[model samples]
Target: MDQRVSSLAPPTIYVVDDDDGVRRALAFALDLDGFEVETFESGEALLLRDGLDAAGCLVLDERLPGISGLDTLRQLRARQVALPAIFVTSHPKPLMRDAAARAGAPIVEKPLEAETLIAAIHDLLRGPTR
Candidate 1:
């Protein structure tokens, strides 16, 4: 973990989902786990934000209205953002998983299990290789 414990800040988790219910549920779950969280309705909203590096991880839905999750992840990588991210979607095809792996992002399918989601969150906190 490349985290600085003395920074006086909790690790922030950014959750980006176009669906209102999903965004709310995920945010609630993360918050309940004592993580600082920020929720966004779309990739474009997140793209317009500043200081993304402050976040410890990003939990993003693979499909979005504009600038899809994969594309957003590509942009983030292009910008050299090192934040760990996990991609979630209803359609977790082999090709998508391969691409995500290539981009250093991991995939988590929808109907997300509590255990799996928490484990992924831990893995994100653990760092990229985990």
Candidate 2:
């Protein structure tokens, strides 16, 4: 086994999106980019799993059915789960952006370019300053 690979646990990406196509497409893309992925249809599904303790980042759609992505992040924070998160949405209003910022999540607009999302994920994994 490669020493580097053995030294670090594989990074898993938790993706929460209401759109079936979008969730599947993102999982496919991220998998191809060499990241492990877990998909949820809604923020509620993710919260129910109680599996956020894993070493990974979160890619969430802002306007989820049950709990909004920002609210989900807030809940996670309240629980002391500090995973890096990125929010994607078609509507990028100032209020949403501010909320996401407060949660320490970057908001990416929908109709996302695959490369950009991938790059952002990589950057987040690298750490906040990177």
lDDT, candidate 2, 13-92, per-residue tens: 99999999998999999999988899999888888877674579999898888889888878788888889999999979
- Give one digit per residue, the lDDT tens place, for model 1 in 1-130: 5556656576788889999988888878888887888899988898888898555898888999988998887888788787888999887888898999897788888888756887888877876452
RMSD of 2: 1.8
Cα distance off (Å), candidate 1, residue 18: 0.5
- In order, the Cα lDDT scores of the candidates are 0.83, 0.86
Question: TM-scores across all candidates?
Answer: 0.87, 0.91
For model 2 the TM-score comes to: 0.91
- C-alpha lDDT of residue 25 in model 2: 91
Error of 2 at 84 (Å): 0.3
lDDT of 2 at 73: 79
Model 1 clashing residue pairs (backbone) = none
